[model samples]
Target: MAAFDGSTDYDVTLEIPVSIGGLELPNRLYRAPLLEHAGDDDPVDRLLDELEPCAEAGVGLLMQGATPIRGREGRAAPGMTGFEDPDRVASMSRLTDRIDAHGSRIFAQLAHGGLRSMEVWHAGYRRRNPGLRQRVVSKPPLPLRLADRLGILSIDADPLSTDEVYELAADFGRAADRAAAAGYHGVHLAGATMGIFQQFLSPFYNRRDDEFGGALDDRLRFFEVVHEEIRARTDVPLVTKVPAETETPWFVRESIDAEEAIEACRRLAEIGYDAVVPVGSSPFWDHAIIRGEFGSRGFDDRVSRGFEAAFGGPWRRRLVELAARIDAATTPFEAAWNADLCRRVRAVVDVPVLCVGGIRGRSEADRLLGDACSMVGMARPFYAEPRLAARLLAESDATAVCESCNNCVPPQAVGEPGVCRTPAVLKQRGEFEKRGAYEREGGNRRRDSDGPKL
Candidate 1:
């Protein structure tokens, strides 16, 4: 059934298999978690020695970014990484035996920055709001979004009282059963930037007049009861990352439109959500429009064709012919226009469409496996080459150098960790302080005390 001609170059052992649930991923080229305030409290030998050179750099699905779940004022930092500590699940079983001995499949991005919790980057449990205001309330210079920086540090917000929003929908199904009992080959729900499911799909921090909020079906009824109690506990794999709308007017929200972000991707494809990733966040809504972010680049196939026309489905003409083969790239020249937009978004989405922004090397990872978007996420070139899929299968030019350097999503380096002032991550300050700051309390808002700092 070979029909994907986005331009062909993939063979990390013959690409093609993305399967999610019982973890199949051999190559779709993923390594996008970056946030390296690398899991604190005895973080297993500095996160398996910075993921053993990123699983000897052959990435196939090496996730793990946000982590924190069972509260500690719902962490976002103080150097994140706490799977609600049950004695730190053997630091994720020594990070799943060195990413399954380098074959690659480690998943764990489960976050909870709710209202973007930032007590000077999570110094720990300060949000105790009774709407008593004045924690230093000034806000309005505009760049304050993340539900107004989690309502000026009025944490553990009161609005969630529908039995604490069904006890945070069973604490997101017991934090996805503690990242699938810590073997993790599944569990990516950090619902983009102002995380905590985009602060329960923000209506500017859900004023919650009940059911959950006022509209957008009561703000996706607490994410459909935390995706039906984390898909009823778990068969592993879930991956959600939404927010193409509703955040102080970015993707232009009218009660979270685009048919409610395609009815929240047809309710994460009716709850068996294997993958969804859409992300786009620079104006305060989980951004979605990909790299350029002002809007339009296959904005997840015109918003998954409004969730394939509200689930009438035929995969909505394969997600609008993979957004006209990723709007036939007018720029980002090379890697055959990203394998013809991943062979025109895998010729219409049978479930694989991945691609995340400004890819790094191996000719954009061989046009991201010659254009079929099964995987190729790359958060800021894995904080300036974390062995980027092993220097792109050793064709090395330092994997065609990624000096784009926005300095991997800044925000005061969350408390400082992912320090790649380039020069190859500053010749390892003890592996950049044991691999930190991929983005825990960094850029999602903080510079405006009086604005100046660029």
Candidate 2:
């Protein structure tokens, strides 16, 4: 398909080099962040195994999944590494060297899970390790608190004091400094997806009356302070992911809509952010971020292990699962789902705008790159095909094979590597493995007999 007016080739459009905050990337395709779940094992090696293939295949940019800025207390799930470890600099240096050797720029995504921390969500974890409560911007909404009391939700939260807010922002800066010292090309702040930044920015969470809350501009002060702190420590290019809470339930009146999100991006650009990634997200975790068919297999597998550990009990687990199914039915997969938001943000911001939602095919990506966004990104697709960029850059008709089953997501909360688990995809990959496809050609080669195709 043509990129624009049947004049520009889609392949050429995707292959075009772009500069983001002075970092000249080789192409417009990037690997969006998804947890690797390296566990207590050698995380650097596991991360290298998961990310090096994308870099080696000529992916332009790789955003390492959310790494905890603090120690264990900051992790959202198991297997997440952090910057607080003394050997983090050396370990990260090794990772950066491997990606840079392949000429791919890698950015460390610094994050701190606030309300979404495992301490709040995982009953087993919290019980096993006491005294480490999940930190929050303020007390959770009344409904959430009531749910906790009624045994419908497991929430143990510690509201951050006014001074603690600044301290957490400095932690972000310190993480950025460590990332720079580790030889990363840049740092991507986890400003969305229920992280600490989102807790501050989303009115659903931040009810504080201090300078960090109340008005939208006041809520955005946390991000501004974080930007200042990072800049004070290092000069690396900074990128952030901001959520447009477009999918909030109808009953939810106070949320960040498209206009507010656009203004937020404008302010971020003004504060010297190199680029912005605008995604459709929710203050609460559901399938909105990775919208698709609910992976009942993965969810059942996780819950059957021990529902009480994650959810309050079997009944609560069933209720949550039922809600997820309904949510999936309401929000089915739509390719390039964030294109409209990216277009809106791009219209006003002078900086590059990157987008990632359900962009699967070359045509969809080309359409977005033609006018909507400066760069296109995908997360689960990389899980299905690690060397996806090679084919995407080589063939204009290329489409990722990820079925969007969402099976790769649930297992991560239980400390499993984010790899494609769809049986047909796995069968195809196994056939390729037998033929030594990966060893011979970096897994980019495709045969007509390669089982089922997407």
**Highest-TM-score candidate:** 2
Question: What digit string (tens of lDDT, one per residue) describes model 1 on residues 1-454?
Answer: 3333444444422233455554676556677776677656677677776665666555667776777675454555546777766658645776786677667777887776654554322222343322231111112123344423533222333334567668767877887777777677777777767665665665654555666767666666766787678778777877766555422344433334334554564455454566665543422422233232122322343344433332234444354335434432322223222333334434433344455656666555554544445566766566555665544544433343444434333332234465345555455423533554221221112112332100
Give the C-alpha miss distance for residue 75 in model 1, angstroms: 24
lDDT of 1: 0.53
Give the Å error, residue 380, model 1.
Answer: 12
Please give, for residues 1-454, the per-residue lDDT of candidate 2 as tens digits.
1111212233336667777888877778899998887654568888899999998887889999988888767688877877766576557788898888787899989888887887777778777878786788888987678768867667767888889989988988988998899899999988888888888888888899888999888999999999999999999999999988889987667888888998898888888888899999987777888899988767665545655567767777777678888998888999889998988887777788898999998778888887788889999999998877877887788788889988777777777778898889877756655754444233222223423110
Error of 1 at 234 (Å): 18
Model 1, residue 445: distance off in Å is: 36
Query: TM-scores of the models, in the given order?
Result: 0.31, 0.91
Candidate 1 Cα errors over 4 Å, as ranges: 1-30, 33-54, 58-61, 64-95, 98-107, 111-161, 180-189, 193-196, 199-201, 204-207, 210-279, 282-310, 313-356, 359-388, 392-396, 400-454
